[model samples]
Target: MPIQNPLKKGSRDPYVTIAQQQLIALGYGLPRFGADGELGDETLFAYGTFLVSQGLRAPTDERPKSITPAGTAALDKAFAALAQGGSTANIIDERHNHPHSGRSVSMPYRPWPKITAVVLHQTATKIGEKPASWHGVPIHFGITRAGKIIQLYDLTEVCNHANGLNRPSVGIEIDGWYAGIEGRPETLWQPKNLSTPRQPMNFPTAQAEAAMTIVQWIVNAVAANGGRVTHIHPHRQSSKDRQSDPGSLIWQTVGLWAQNTLGLSDGGAAFTVGNGRTIPEAWDARYTGNRY
Candidate 1:
């Protein structure tokens, strides 16, 4: 059913739920409140953001009070494109411009063994959206704050991002500094000597959605190449020093959501690949350890 026009805040129409679901599917996260059929603040904010993303609205404009006809059409078009694998249109391939240093001198690019997982990370500082900003970065994908997905390396090449999981996993670097645990003071794991003071940043809905889309893209690409991506991990799971690599908010919004929605796994609560720490209990309640 098409979303009813003028679906403003406080509206509890079924169409409102439909819009919410579409927004969530596109990566405008309603973390606090889900698609509950109520056009509340969270949903409205997500809707406005979506409108802004599609150039239907301006950033300086106030959050849209009602879902206009144009917004509804734009939402439907985007959703249809996503269903038809149009999400790849959002990716900017910079692999040719910025290649990774291959794993060995003998072979410039080592073929990936069998990609089974994706490790997520945060830059711990702002990273620009241009290809020049990601030069020499080891990660396969880098998502900027504005939700641009930049491919820095080919999936077939074994680029070193995670310690032990490089060969079997792909890496996604979400651009921003986020706290390991939200609302907590940053002590260790805080980037040092920055020209400006570092503050905790929230994962924008678009960036989070880009991360989700890329994860699905990886799963599809790997399957096409005779491999299956079965797990989604945080960089912290592969390096003890990266206790806050991507942080809890991101894990809950993107990682845990992937496991629940996309049928992916996090290697269980106690599962840790290398000499790194476990996915902290704060990130996932299944892990009964306090090691964060």
Candidate 2:
């Protein structure tokens, strides 16, 4: 004999209403008709049996709570908002609705992953200055000279690079030439407030600041989605064995900001290398997949 649990009063939806009667008829204890919010324990038991009869196991308890009518309406509204590129986080002031780019770039793909880390790279070229395109060019999210962040590829997708592709990461390209440390003498450029390292050329403070803001945006976005800021990494750190883009200075700067400002532990990495390859130790959190 199943224990009776009655539905609350005045409920009426065809499926629920029918389900209620079915439970009552099936020798399950339940509320009498005309007083109800939804089917109770006995009804749910009967529903489970109904489903099992159809060759399916009962829906697991681990599933998200069943959608109520009100919840369903709210979800529809949320999807609408997301489609408009609305800002979903409450703490962040910035609301990006598709950043503007002067160069001809691809559309923003929306398969936004957990956004573990922000990998920064100097574009190594000016805006609209095309790089030689063979097949399998790496894609990037670009922040132009004017400080606009635009999507270079859809989310969770990969572009060609010297290293891994499509494993798990997003790349961002800032417009600038990456004059390696060896090229500093000819470029005659240096970073302000610090003795420039062995290589230096055209350290754009404005661009750096903008890049920080974007990183903050990404961090906030991840946090809002139940992730943490500790996962952020620059491109150089990811492929330390053979690559460098956002050079050491920018990496130190952004990483320190993440630690000091965001208060993240800086543990866990996001990049991994194998097949006789190696990713830098700093990027361990981003690639291996860390949970917030």
Candidate 3:
């Protein structure tokens, strides 16, 4: 049957359908016309309510804004390819585990034990950059801007965080760019070429949401593995003085989702600006006495 005129005006695409389904899964039960591609007012209202429940204000307008971090994350989850029915979902280092690698995450070089924590980074590199780096970066899985889950690593153990991927912790490098301190709240704009000065890389709302959903899955994985999940640190967090792949905005937004949606503890800290390290600053001897 053709999508009705009313629903067709702003019909929910496949990604939005996934979002609608996820919202229903989370008990929102937005009015979906049996997955027929028609999103009704009831569905919109339900989504708005879900937002409010997560401590975000309801969307003032009928049409929701996709650019917001929360909105983007939801869209991502809605479209994610779920884990094998009963099996756990994890992203392992494909470099070591790929059938072509001969050895796998199962034996010899597991990227674990030594892995102290999970590092989240964004591939600031352009979408067209060929031969994307798969070095010490442990990002095993990533959600695409279109809400697709791209598996770059397996959760077998770990491979290499440095030389040979680490075993225990996994890395997730999202395809996005920081909007920079001065240009945040604005979408990233692509640069013309290598010769052009570095500019903010913009990620679609659907993609940003996908990144957050991946974080939610990671938190669950950490709990199941018995690894004390401390910091969902961005690449910049590890090298404060030097690197900053995932700018502060992505970190904070994703961290909040981990804390709020999945109900994961933000490690017992109030709120730190950069990494969102949950361990209260007071507890850390390194903290000189900063409140936030």
Candidate 4:
């Protein structure tokens, strides 16, 4: 039997047990209280976190007290995808929901075997969770501030995100402004010769976890399609202007973590393409060069 709609706290339905099993399988832990069929705080927190990961709810929003039809549907879809050996990562596929205005018309289709890296980037501003918020943005994937992964293009489309590496890498734009160095203030260009000063926002834990999940998803996806992703790069490695594109905090949290945990590389210390800047020593002591 399917999970009854509006399953709320204090309900004692057997379906609650089913829901608990599914949540555990989906990687949401009810560690303190295992799937005991009691819709308590632990279960509710996991459910709310799952909703936030799927972009269905904002991090700042209150935890949902009841499971609605939409929530059940999302859970079913995600669980089904996971059963099929697909990614359990919360990704909203909007590849066809928006126009391909962000992709260059002159670029040829890239074969899956050609993909070798996942380039990380920061939007330098906040983007809404909806697909419409990513209109005309040239990135394959965008993770919203709410920790939603929105797929804007097919991996083979070769959107012009990372220069030079564009043909061999898939780009992910992490939402929010992150400074090159944590605790340092940054700014964005404004109209005329003006710039707007802003404080660096800390990369939320939810967003960081989503980044890791997506990178692993990309690796698995590429491998299934006859390719291998051997590297994870910061956008700075491919563009001088993007020296702080993802910044130190992001590089340490995501890029370095990927390299260490996922066995991915940053193309080594002296590695850089075009007129791009190398990963600074501050970001990773592996790079002995002066901070750019």
Task: Name the best candidate (by TM-score).
Answer: 1
**Candidate numbers sorted by lDDT from highest down:** 4, 1, 3, 2
Q: Clash pairs of candidate 4?
A: none
After superposition, candidate 3 runs with Cα above 4 Å error: 1-116, 127-138, 159-168, 180-193, 225-230, 240-242, 261-292
State the lDDT at 157 in candidate 4: 84
Flag the better candidate by lDDT, 3 or 4.
Answer: 4
**Candidate 3, residue 39: lDDT:** 54
Model 1 alpha-carbon drift over 4 Å, by segment: 1-89, 102-113, 193-197
- lDDT for 176 (candidate 1): 85
Steric overlap count per candidate: 0, 19, 31, 0
lDDT digits (tens) for residues 8-121 of candidate 4: 887766556556655765788877865566888788888898999999998955667887767877776665444234467778888888778777567757889998999999
Considering TM-score, where higher is better, how would the candidates rank from best to worst? 1, 4, 3, 2
TM-score of 2: 0.42
Q: Each candidate: what lDDT?
A: 0.76, 0.42, 0.46, 0.77
Best by lDDT: 4
Per-residue CA lDDT of model 1 for 146-237, tens digit only, reads 88989887887777788877777888998887889766647325656868666787666678778878887887778777778899989888
TM-score (C-alpha, index-matched) for candidate 3: 0.48
Write down the TM-score of every candidate: 0.70, 0.42, 0.48, 0.68
